[model samples]
Target: MMPTIVFGVLSVIIIGFALAMVLSKNLVHSAIFMAATFVGVAGIYLTLSAGFLAAVQILIYVGAISILMVFGVMLTRRGDISASNLFNKRIISGVVVSAALFIILGRLILTSEWFPSSFSVPESTVGPIADLMMNAYVIPFETAALILLAAMVGAIILAKGARRTR
Candidate 1:
């Protein structure tokens, strides 16, 4: 009963903040809502007893990614935030497509056979997963980090060049 209640509240938080993030014009506000959504997702992970996933969600998505986005927006944003994504002819078409998608997804959900699970998740899966990531996948992880660094450097160079042109 308690878990179900928590899950319900978390779900509401997730959905509400996600919609707020999408609808918000201010980039900073959107980033804040995005962080809230990430937190809600972490709460759901906690409810499912996925402690590691919850930690990663909070650390990576909420802590790092959201902060990075907010800072990026603050630094790069010119006169107004709403300068981009202005309403146009695309709005009507986008609404129609999204509504059709929602209806199709709703039909799929209604028809799906979702029974209570007899199989339970294991108590702790952190150890083996940690070993695999740290030992076996270490190279891939380092490579990804290097790639991200290169992208950041490229962005900085582009920004500087654009400023010089202006």
Candidate 2:
């Protein structure tokens, strides 16, 4: 009963924040809402007994990605993050595409056969995951980190260049 209530609350939060992120005019506000959506996803991961994934969601999505988005918005010299016009000429085509996607996804979800797992939840997953990351996946992990670092550096350079041009 308690878990159900928690799940319902988290679901509501996730959906609400996602909608807020999409509908918000201010880019900074959208980024903040996206962070909130990420937090709600972390909570969902926790409810599913995937603590490591929850931590990763919070750390990567909320901590790093959302902060990057906010910084990008801040560094821009635009008068306001808000769109001048909410609905453009392409709005009709966009809505049609979105509706088509929704119908396709809904059909897939309803038709999919989900398996019921018989195995119990593991006691600890962090240690084994850490070992795998350090041993087998170290190279790929480091490469990903370097890529993110390079992207950040590139963004900084571009911002500086824009300022110089101004």
Per-model TM-score on C-alpha atoms: 0.75, 0.76
Instruction: Tell me the tens digit of each residue's lDDT in model 2 across 17-105.
Output: 99788767677888999999999999999998889989999999999999998887787537755772244567678879989998999
Candidate lDDT scores, in order, read 0.87, 0.88
State, as a TM-score between 0 and 1, how close model 1 is to the true structure.
0.75
lDDT of 1 at 14: 95
The per-residue C-alpha lDDT of model 2 at residue 130 equals 85
Those runs of model 1 whose alpha carbons end farther than 4 Å from true positions after fitting are 81-89, 113-125, 135-143, 163-166
Cα-lDDT of candidate 1: 0.87
